[model samples]
Target: MAADELKLENQVCFALYAASRAVTSLYRPALDALGLTYPQYLVMLVLWERGPVLVKELGQALDLDSGTLSPLLKRLEAAGLVRRQRCAEDERAVRVYPTDEGGALRDRAMSVPRKLSGATGMGLAELEALRENLVRLTEEITAQQD
Candidate 1:
């Protein structure tokens, strides 16, 4: 390949990175309306699906550290969306549970996926293919990390 042809646009990593940012950007305005960031929205999803879960498990699920997640969890608590409680089995462990407000937020948030899908102009099958590819890529990256 020519030196000039080896530019950043030609790199798959760059493309993926840019696409990820772009997709996240599309969510920003919508998320902002709900007073949440992308990471916070992810945390809500996890709580909605799993209910009261440990803080460490949340970090692992989101690939975040305590340094990052602690403050976020605190903010969620302050917002009345979630509550943090010490685990009975382990005083050192903190568990997160969504409040009624948080659970109700899911009803409002249910429209988001459909709105995003419409914005992307991708049909269900195409979206599924994209999701599958991304999942494979994520697994490969996680394997490399190990």
Candidate 2:
């Protein structure tokens, strides 16, 4: 059964990929009501957690490079959900901040996590532990790549 190692069902990457897509799909309806896509919602989460951040920093936090992030930021700006401004002391650096409307949306978005948690039928502690393990696995893989 050596060939079994190559089977799709035995691939950890495929499992994670499938799980990610499934989780993202579950977020769709909730995100749609917020007028935000999954990536946009992620950006908002970072902003809501950390008031304002530089474009470079935001990119790093999201594990996205400028090429992929720029379009998302543009759409977010177009929606008036976020504002991008050049830093006064560093013209080359752009900082992103949530606009008033975006800040207001935070209150309504609070229910999203609770809803998703209930959908999982898992307790907070279990989810948190799983999240920690996933983060560790991601970090290990990333470090290996580096």
**TM-score winner:** 2
TM-score of 2: 0.91
Off by over 4 Å in 1: 1-10
Q: Write the per-residue lDDT of candidate 2 for residues 1-146, one digit (tens) a residue.
A: 76776785568888899899999999999989999999999999999999999989988998998998889999999999999999999999999999999999999999987788778877889989989999999999899996
- The estimated TM-scores of all candidates read 0.89, 0.91
Backbone clash count, each prediction separately: 0, 0
lDDT of each: 0.92, 0.92
TM-score of 1: 0.89
**lDDT for model 2, on a 0 to 1 scale?**
0.92
Give candidate 2 misplaced runs (Cα > 4 Å). Answer: 1-10
- The count of residue-pair clashes in candidate 2 stands at 0
